[model samples]
Target: MIWIDTLAQGILLGGLYALFAAGLSLVFGIMRLVNLAHGDFIVMAAYLILLLVTLMGLSPFVAAIIAAPVMFGIGWGLQKHLLNRTLGNDILPPLLVTFGLSIALQNALLEGFSADSQRLPTGAISTASIDLGVLTVGVLPLLTFGSAIAVIVGLNQLFYRTELGRAFRATSDDATTASLMGIRPGNIFAIATAIAMLVVTLAALYLGMRSNFDPNIGPARLIYAFQAVIIGGLGSLWGTLAGGIIIGLAQTVGAAVNPEWQILAGHVAFLIVLLVRPRGLFPRAVD
Candidate 1:
C-alpha cells in the first residue's frame, strides 16, 4: 500500500514536470531554436501572475488568464525582433543570445523580488486532496496532471488540424521553401513561440501554486525540462509526458527507499534511459 501510494504521488508529480517541458518541446519542435531562457521565462510568468494577484486582489487563475496574453505578446516580440535574427545554420548565436537573456532575466527578477522564495496563495486548493480506494491524491496534483494532458492535446490539435499548423510544419521542414510558398517562416516562428509562451503561462500558474520558486530556480527547472524532452524524444509531445513520469517515478521511489537519493535517482534514470536508447524512448523522425 505504501509503495502504491508512492507511485501514485510520483505520477501526479510528473504532471507538473510535463507542464514544465511542454513549451520547451513545442519551441524546439518547430524552430529547433533552443531558448536557454525558457525556464526563466516560466519564472517570469509566475512573477507576472503574482503581481496581478497582489495588486488587484485577483484570484491566481484570473491572474494567469490575464498573464497569458501578455506573455504571448512578449514571446512574439522577442522572436520577431530578437531571437529570429540569431537563427541560422550556426546555433551558437542563439545559444549565446538566450544565455544572456537568461542571465538578464535572473538579475532583473532578483532586483525586483529580492532573493526570497515565493509561492502563490492557492487557499484551500493547496491542501485539497481526493481519496481513492487504494491511495489518496492531492487535488492540486490531479489538476496539474489534467492540465498537462489538456495542453498536449490542444497543441496536437493545433498542429494536426489547423491551417496554421500546416504552415508550421512546412516552415519547420524548410524555411526557404516555406517562404517561397508565401508562408513567412519568421512570422510563423514568432507565432509558434507566442503559443509556447501561453503554455509557459499555464505551467507558471501550477508551478507557483505547487512549490516555492525563486529566480535562481529556473536553471534547475530547465535541466528537468531538458532531461524530460531528451528522455521522451525531441519533437514528440506525448513522449515528453512519458519522460516526466519516468523521472517522477524514479524520484518518488528513491525517496521512499531513502530521501537522500531522490534527486540523484531522477538523474540516474535519465542516464539509464540514454544508455538503453540514445535517441530517447520515442525518437521522432526529423526529415
Candidate 2:
C-alpha cells in the first residue's frame, strides 16, 4: 500500500518534470536548436509572475496569465533579433550564444532578485488534498498532472491539426526550402519560440507553486530537463513525459529504500535506459 502511494506520488511528480521538458522538446523538435538558456527563461517567468502578484495583487493564476504574453514577446524578439542569427550548419554558435544568454540571465536575475529563494503564494490550495481510499493526494499535484496532460494534448493538436503546424513541419525539415516556398523560416522559428515561452510560463507557475526557486537553480533544472529530453528521445513530446515518469518513479522508489540514493538513482536509471536503448524508449520516426 505504501509502495503504491509512493509510485502514485512519483507519477504526480513526473508531471512537473514533463512541464519542465515540454518547451525544450518543442524548440528542439522544430529548430534542432538547443537553448541552454531554456531553464533560465522559466525562472525568469516565475519571477515575472511573482512580480505581477506582488505589484498588482493578482492571484498566481491571474499573474501567470498576464506573464504569458510578456514572455511570448520576449521569446519572439529573442529569436527574431538574436537566436535566428545563430542557426545553420554550425551547431556550435547556437550553443555558445544560448550558453552566454544563460549566464547573462542568471547574473541579471541574481542582481534583481538577490540570492534568496522565492515561491508563489498559493493560499489554502497549496495544502489542499483529496482522499482516494487507498491514499491521499495533494490537489496541487493532481492539478499539475492534469495540466501536463492538457499541455501535451494541446501541443499535439497544434502540431498535427493546424496550418501553422504544417508550416512548422515544413520549416523544420528544411529552412531554405521552406523559405523558397515563402514560409519565412525565421518568422516560424520566432513563432515556435514564442509558443515555447507560453509553455514555459505554464511550467514556471507550477514550479513556483511546488517549490522554492532561486536564479542559481536554473542550471540544475536545465540538467533535469535535458535528461528528460534525452531519455525520451530528442524531439519526441510524448516520450518526454514517459522519461519524466521514469525518473520520478526511480527517485521516489530510491528514496523509499534509502534517501541518499534518490537523485543518484534517477541518473542511474537514465544511464540504464541509454545502455539498453541508445535511441530512447520512443525515437521519433525519420522521414
Candidate 2: residue pairs that collide: none
lDDT (tens digit, per residue) of candidate 2 on 1-287: 99899999999988888898999999999999889999999999999999999999999999999999999999999999999999988989999999999999999999999989999999999999999999999999999989988999999999999999999999988888998988999899999999999999999999999999999888877777777888898778889999888888898999999999998988999999999988888889452
Highest lDDT model number:
1
> What TM-score number comes out for model 2?
0.97
Q: For model 1, how does the per-residue alpha-carbon lDDT over 1-287 read when each residue is reduced to its tens digit?
A: 99899999899888888898998998898889889999999999999999999999999999999999999999999999999999998989999999999999999999999999999999999999999888888999999999999999999999999999999989988889999999999899999999999999999999999999999998878888888999999889999999999988999999999999998999999999999999999999462
RMSD of 2: 1.2
- Candidate 1 lDDT at 91 equals 80
Q: What does the lDDT come to for candidate 1?
A: 0.93
